[model samples]
Target: MPNCQTESHPPATTTSPPASKAPQTTEALQAEQAPVARDWRAPSQQEIAERKKQLSPDQFKVTQQQGTEAPFRNPLWNNHAPGIYVDIVSGEPLFSSKEKFESGTGWPSFYRPLDPQRIVEKHDDSYGMDRVEVRSKSGDSHLGHLFDDGPAPTGLRYCINSASLRFIPAERLAAEGYASFAYLFPEVKQVLPQSEPTSGR
Candidate 1:
């Protein structure tokens, strides 16, 4: 739910009635119009079946069966790119590069999510470990676990599975229909287009 906001302009004269609501920021407006506004509900039985066929054996196992991939060897563990990570199943934006950090855990770790609402945390007591399990709200895919040991700002580590996510580089956000999130990288100055949503890999 963390978002950017522009500074407000001077207030209107008290003589005239103030507007009922404040003006929406550019980010807010862009979010409302973003292609991500499409329905991102839980996958149905048929959808799940289709996904099983579309996804790789490792991806399906980790995301659908709650299986974990080997650490350090996963695709994104050492990734240092400027981009966003989204739910592999639903394509819902989950984490940004801005929050990513090396946790020495050999997994892709983040201090927080791009939008907290897109993530669901549940008490996990599996394998004799008391932890919090992170899942994608829309896709209902088992992402990974959360731990308290982390860096500043947010003292929480989202230890996620690479199989459960798809990385979209900053420059390709607009083309990938995630233009609203382009603001996360101010250094990449590109006119983000309003593109149609894509079915994630």
Candidate 2:
């Protein structure tokens, strides 16, 4: 969860006060749960241009120019591997690969975001297509679109451009400083068929 926009909720790694306690003062409790303040400033147009000079032409086009990789041509298109996907522009982790699955419509799709608050959704009416545009909540960098036709729990498919993401395997989550979340994935769990979310329900 390094360098992410922990917007409304506290980081999932924070150590909560013991629940055994009768409970503390309301003010003190609220203070403890508050998310850390973040500096939301972004690079100016000129600064963005200046920074663009540093990226390769392709990276610049994809990251700064808002160009997308051809459908199914990118490596993440059919990726069902377990890991996380990071923002190509700022290298900020955005979606977990564990949640990735095929949506048959091409492009990489995920059931949910690694961090719900790490992204911001905006009504995108571009190209005469009414789509939900997804952007980095912290960096505000354009990632891609999200759809409502995904698998359950949160039936949302974060259909993102592969050029907009960089995948990192689960084994490297710790090396990437997201080790604290290892528990999120257990060695074994009750898994349901794609058509149903309950194993014996």
Each candidate: what lDDT? 0.71, 0.57
lDDT of 2 by residue, 7-86 (tens): 12221231222222232221232332323213223446576556556666656566655566556456787776676687
lDDT of 1 by residue, 166-191 (tens): 99999988777777777777799665
Clashing pairs for model 1 are: none
Worst 10 residues of 1 by lDDT: 1-10
Highest TM-score: which candidate? 1
Cα RMSD for predicted model 2: 16.6
Model 2 Cα shift for residue 82 (angstroms): 1.4
Write down the TM-score of every candidate: 0.72, 0.63
Clashing pairs in 2: 83-97
Q: Which candidate is the best by lDDT?
A: 1
Candidate 1: segments with Cα more than 4 A from true spot: 1-49, 189-201
Model 2 global lDDT (CA atoms, 0 to 1): 0.57
